[model samples]
Target chain A: MTAASATVLITHPTGLHARPAVKLTKLAKTFEAAIRLRPDGQEGWIDAKSIVKVMGLKLRSGSRLELAAEGVDAPDAVAQLRALVERNFDENV
Target chain B: MTADTVGIVIVSHSPKVAEGAADMVRAMVGDGVRVACCGGNPAGGLGTDAARILAAIEEVWSPQGVAVLVDLGGAEMNAEMAIEMLDEGRGAQVRVCNAPIVEGAVVAATEASAGSSLDAVCAAAEELCQ
Candidate 1:
């Protein structure tokens, strides 16, 4: 609803692999918003709604990212996303 | 060994693709185990409805347990939901394994079903990723 709720981006050295991407997609689906991700200098946003699209980014750790969620749940979406990246998707750790 | 009957469900963007992958693996194992493919129009593709796929998994395993193998990401979600449903419906008697549909996965699933424990089946699947 607000520009402040557009989206948030985080990059992990591991990038978003199978497990983390799965978690993120599931969480994103809970909110009434459209989510997208842009991996540093890449044109066009990737659909965060689709796990395949998110995985297609092949993001690795240290890759700066741009995450944007537009909708009533944008803020929450961004918050959760930040948490997920901060945890490095908890990949088998 | 009490003759454990393990079931497999393969989901992919295309039904034929899933079937083809299964067929390739079956070529090596034959009909020794119960293998089912979900997805694709003709195969009735588990209907994007998690419950539907879960029902199919339950039906396939019935009194026993099943090890589910799904292709791609969305199908994995569908598989996860199916496993949860089956677990709730059948309890510990029904189980699910998340494994790739690649050559190694196919080989491991078939071998594990032959005599290995569910944990082993899962381990075999994990080995493929390595």
Candidate 2:
């Protein structure tokens, strides 16, 4: 099984705080794939499906993130997550 | 969307605190998990009420189970009393967790929304203190 990955810039003014982190984790739960994320230049990837872990990233606006998903729906998971990031988690900036 | 997941209740001395904590949990878990808030005295004072806690528990009751996150000392006692007020069968499915109200509620709600068992949800909430 191949892993699908994408690099996205955090656009939400507050970054991956509580609200956006919740959105990210909730969306990640919808797919069967295992999702992992890390700051663009960071070394470690954390479980994207865990709200606490996602919030711990403390990503700020303009911080780039690398997301990877592995499983049957890896491609779909990666695409949807990328779209969510691009949409700023649908929150007003 | 109900997947044998545990439910959550927030008990606080102030109504706003409970509601705000519930809001945070809702934001994290979305609409899938059940969450309820119980706060303030019956007279609308800054104190916990057993009746209100009981109502909140009933509001989010589920066969899977319910976890109550409380703030302060009195809140826990009221929460326990509220659980005891339930019928034996229903009461058996409820637990008052020892965790920070806001953080525990969020963690518990997140775990519950993922269809976690009652024990798992409680464990997740309790783990936040570590």
Candidate 3:
């Protein structure tokens, strides 16, 4: 199985709030990877595909995040999730 | 609405509240699962109605099962009444979740869109109550 990881910054004004968290989880579900995330300084990881877990993180704007994935599509999953965070989940309008 | 994904219903005393919760579900989940709302009495004021709730359930009926999120005790009671009014087999596929209405519905809808089972979707919504 392939593995991939990324470090990203939450740049959205509200960080990973409801809409962004939902989008992130939904996008993660499209992948065949088992993905997990942790805040830059946090101790444990949360499932990247679980809306409840993603929202529970309460990640705020400017928070740095660490993501890891393992599976056939791990590399693509990590890359896309990193881009989503960078694009602020496309909320800038 | 995929037959493999669970359905969702939002029940609230106020029409706006139920619709608002349903809107949140739509915004979050993008309609992968069927969702319906029942709010206010037949007169359209702020109140719960079993008949209206029943119609909402049927509106989003899916053999995959449905998980209902209610805003208040009356809404929950009316949802229960609506379920009881259903044929026994169909009623067996529904559950009234005990959780905060908006958040619960949003999370439950996401789980449903993820193709979670009926019981899993209900549990996802109820988890917020703890």
Number of the top DockQ candidate: 3
| Residues B35-124, model 2: lDDT tens digits | 999788988789999998898888888899999999999999888888889997688899988789998899889878888789988887
The two-chain DockQ for each candidate, comma-separated, is 0.01, 0.41, 0.65
Candidate RMSDs in order: 14.6, 2.2, 1.6
Q: On a 0 to 100 scale, what is the lDDT of residue A47 in model 1?
A: 70
Q: In angstroms, how far off is B119's CA in candidate 2?
A: 3.1
- Candidate 2: the clashing residue pairs are none
How much of the true A–B contact set does each candidate keep? 0.00, 0.33, 0.54
Instruction: List the candidate 1 regions with Cα displacement exceeding 4 Å.
Output: A1-93, B1-3, B41-47, B62-64, B87-98
Q: Of the candidates numbered 1 and 3, which has the greater lDDT value?
A: 3
Candidate 2: clashing residue pairs, number: 0
* TM-score against native, each model: 0.48, 0.88, 0.93
Real A-B contacts recovered, model 1: 0.00
Model 3 chain A is weakest, by summed lDDT over 10 consecutive residues, at: A84-93
Question: In candidate 2 chain B, what residue range of length 10 has the lowest lDDT sum?
Answer: B1-10
**What digit string (tens of lDDT, one per residue) describes model 1 on residues A1-93?**
632233334455556765466566656656677878878787889777554466567777677667787887788888887777777765544
List residue ranges in candidate 3 displaced over 4 A. Answer: none
The alpha-carbon deviation from the true structure for residue B97 of candidate 3, after best TM-score superposition, in angstroms, is 1.3
